[model samples]
Target: MGVIVDEQVLTCSIPPARFFKAFFVDSNNLFPKILPTVFKSIEYTEGNGGPGSIKLLSFQEGSGADVMKHRIEEMDEANLVYKFKIIEGPKMGVLDFESVSSVNKVEGAADGGCILKSVVTYNTKGDNQNAIQETIKKAKEGFVGFFQATVGHLQSNPDAYN
Candidate 1:
């Protein structure tokens, strides 16, 4: 497998706790409702639906559903970090690959808000290591869409975010 590396930063004006809780901590239930265009549905296929749990995300309506499927490989609720593995779908080479996602909290500007940065490390099916640029671009676009939708939704309805 050929590893593909990419990083994207998303900053939200809302408080970190609010954005974090809504997006990361409680996203499985809230994301589908907030952004159906990019999130058709998220279902827990294994584990306790918490740390070490694995869930399935299909993108028929969410994010075009062309990139990939995910499996949560690890979780750390206290630190607000989790890892997910790519199980299937069309990303990188032939999609038969392994990837882990790490979510790290970033210190924002003087204006306090949550800056959640997710770095995904992935690989392709073949040994050629091709498609790195395209794969990275696609991942960045998908993540940007997610963050934009989330920030817009929260801004429109502040009370809901709380």
Candidate 2:
């Protein structure tokens, strides 16, 4: 299988602890509420919300993809790090990818804000370099959208995820 890796970094004004709590720890509840048009729901299909757990994220109608299943590989709450692997998804089938995994880390910045660093690895089935790149582009865009929405929500609702 051909492997492709992509790295991204995003800087936000929110503090690392707050951002991590809202975006990572509480995403299953916050995402659907914030992006109702895009996300239908996020629920655990197996185990609790921890390592070895399986999460199923269902998208709303006309959202291009129906649902995605992810397995939590690691979760370091104290260090604000999370890792997960996409076990099933329409995107994987359409793009001919064998597997997709990501590691997200949030760190405190000098200005009291936070920086989010993400590393995504894609395992492809064949020599579809172009397709893999396109998928990576879309994934980056999606991450930005989600990040912005979460930031907005946390900014507006000060009590959220406290």
Residue 62, candidate 2: Cα error in Å is: 1.9
Candidate maximizing lDDT: 2
TM-score of each: 0.79, 0.95
RMSD of 2: 1.3
Off by over 4 Å in 1: 61-68, 92-96, 106-109, 127-130
Q: Give a tens-digit lDDT track for model 1, residues 21-97.
A: 67766678877887777767777777756666667775664344553456666556556566676666665235535
C-alpha-based local distance difference test score of model 1: 0.66
Query: Where does candidate 1 have its weakest 10-residue lDDT segment?
Result: 91-100
For residues 1-162, what per-residue lDDT tens digits would candidate 2 score against the true structure? Answer: 887889999998899989998888878998999999989999999988899999999999997689999999988889999999999997577557989999999999999899999999988887767766777888899999999999999899888777
